[model samples]
Target: MDDDGLFTIGALARRTGLTVKTIRFYSDTGIVPSTDRSPAGYRLYDINALARLDLVRTLRDLGLELAVIRQVLDREISVPEVAAAHADALEVQIRTLRLRRAVLRAVAKRGSTPREMNLMHKLAKLSDEERRRLVSDFIDDAFGGLEANPEFVAMMRSAMPDLPDDPEPEQVDAWVELAELTQDPDFRAAVRRMAEYQASERAQGDTTGLHHDLTEAVRDRVGHALASGIAPDAAEAVPIVNDLTARYARTFNRTDDEDLRDWLLTRLEIANDPRAERYWHLLAVINAWPAPPSLAPVFAWLTEALRAGTSSRPTTV
Candidate 1:
């Protein structure tokens, strides 16, 4: 400290743990202007200047820009307000970095080709609203203007892919696959067919909503048959098939006869597309929803059982 209650640039550096060049830069930038000049033309700083230099170093360490720090020093903005704004900005940066990490991890795990990696990164970079729009457009193409099952359409619209800020690699993969699947012309055609089938049923005055109870009944009965190793064509499956068809007959207000079996078989065939099941699976993965049990096996079992039962019947000549 000098006798005039001031310090030279080198003394301020030693006290503040900053190099003389950095202190000099801050002084030159008017962030911590020197309070006086020594007789030899050396810059000298008073205690207030020293305090300003400390604040400048701290703000710089916190990733604040020079202009913002200048504003802070000039009292153009309060420190608390600047801190809050910077904190919000940092949150966005953190989220972006986390998403980048997830995309890189997905690329590494998948050993993606250059084109595939490019696509993954592009999909990952989409904003949440953009992501939802991609799915919404697919849903619209499939069911828009068609009187598809209202409950089922509502379920599809509501179950959108919502990738989190810090997604897992699998979630990233799921999102990429889902984005591709929804954009696929073939898959879109298949889903549109399903929508058309539902619309046709509606035209036939079949106004029943989604039969969750009937679906559960099928899943439960078929899952048990599968676990028991009963073949779909085996005689043991007859009672199980009878029980399920009876339940479906009651639910759809149809007779438990050959005609009903044929109709149920057709319904199963239309709904049994593996890609359709995959659509829900990918959505479940991306949204971090509880993984839905695979319905492909259950539906396959029921379809085969219905077919086998139909084949055993005598043909009308």
Candidate 2:
């Protein structure tokens, strides 16, 4: 300290733990202007200048630009305001970094080709609203102007892929697959056919909504039959098939006869597309929802059993 209670640039460097060149640069920029000069014209700083240099260094460490830090030092903006703005910016950066990490991890896990990696990165980087729009477009294409079951359509619209900021690699993979599935022409045509079938049924005065109970009944009965190692064509499946057909008969106001069995088989064949099951599975994974039981196996069992017991060939819609 000089007799004037000021510190030379070298003294300020030692006190503030900053290199002499850095302190001299700040002094030259007038960010922490030299308060005085010694007899030999050395840059001298007082207590306030030392305080300003410390604040500048701290802000710089926090990724603040020199321009913003200068405004903070000049009192053009308050520190809290700058901090809040920077924090919001940092949040966007953090989300972007997390997404990148997820894409890279997914690429590594999948051993993806360059083309696949590029697609994954593009799809994963979509904004939340953009992601929702992609699904919404698919639903519209599949069900637009068709009297599809309202409940099922509602469920489809509601269960959109919501990739989180810090997504797991599985979630990333699911999202990428989902995006591709929604865009697949064959898958889209199949879903549209399902919608048309539903619309046709609706037009025929079949005003039934989604038959959750009927579905659960099939899954339960067929799941039990599957667990017992009973083949769909085995005699043991006859009673199980009869029970499920009776349930469906009551649910859809039809008689439990050969006709009902044939109709039920047609419905199962239409709904049992493996891609359809995969669509839901991916949605469950991306949204962190409990995986719905694999209805594919259950539906397959019932379809084969119906075919075994009834004189009906698989109908293509």
Candidate 3:
């Protein structure tokens, strides 16, 4: 190509778009050798050198180290093998960057404090097993060793939250909130108290617990009533309330008496706690679980309807 079937370093630079300094460095490192020396002692390369330089440039663009690129050019290892290994490394890098992006987005949305930001970063970096163990430990502390009803424990475990490798911003926020909730002594105590009460109920063989078929009945019937804008204390609510009370009584094999209604009202009151609702909501977010409908509105309507019905009774002198 040049005067004598060899191109000078400057000529090769022009052809490959690499700088003369770069080509000379590659030649010095024996990655791309010069085929001859000109009369002025200038380095010159043949067509083979030009192709090797191109391969080196391409590999560099792909984030391969120079040493590895040299091995690739020397044919000591196949290009595909090196590319495959680099691809796996890049995959890990991409995952880390994605998680960092999610964490920063969450911080931006919340305008979190420095301390909170630090905590979020730490939480986002946990391994899958670490995250699972953190959740499992929390559940254990919250409901463990209270002679918890087996069904109740199983349900709690099933609802445990797990962060995916690539989480959305809201999912990251949900995970951070969940981790904080698990660490709160008050929350732990509240859940434990409920667990103990449920265990005691199970022992009594009353089994009238909300977990029974009564939950679905109340959710469906009361949900419909609330959607229709029926006032809990209105006369129109009487039939709905009566139907719910009858269903619950039938489930427990008891008459729908005043005392039974009172007990049911108390249980519903406990079940409607906002913290418990938050727990389930967070789990749904982390695990991408389908959200169960809010039962608070229905429970509140039932509570008011039950009280109003009780108060309308004629007082005997």
What digit string (tens of lDDT, one per residue) describes model 3 on residues 1-317?
67677898988999999999999999999999999998899888998888889999999999999999989988999999998999999999998999999999999999999999999999888887787788789889977777666776778777766777789999999988998888888988888877877777677676543454677888888888888888888777877777777766666555624477676676666556777888888889988989877777778788888877632221221
Please write out the lDDT profile of model 2 over residues 22-98, one tens digit for every residue.
Answer: 98888888899999888898888889998889899999999999999999999999999999999999999999999
Model 1 residue 237 lDDT?
91
lDDT of each: 0.89, 0.89, 0.81
TM-score per candidate, chains pooled: 0.92, 0.92, 0.82
Model 1, 177: alpha-carbon shift in Å? 1.5
lDDT per residue as tens, model 1, 165-250:
99999999999999999999999999999999999988977789888898899899999999999999998998788788777777
The list of candidate 3 runs beyond 4 A from truth reads 160-166, 206-212, 224-246, 253-262, 303-317
For model 1, name the residue pairs that clash. none
Q: What's the candidate order when arranged by decreasing lDDT? A: 1, 2, 3
Candidate 2: list runs displaced more than 4 Å. Answer: 256-259, 309-317
Candidate order (TM-score): 1, 2, 3
Which residue pairs collide in model 3, if any?
none
In terms of lDDT, the poorest run of 10 residues in model 3 is: 308-317
Task: Check candidate 2 and list the clashing pairs.
Answer: none
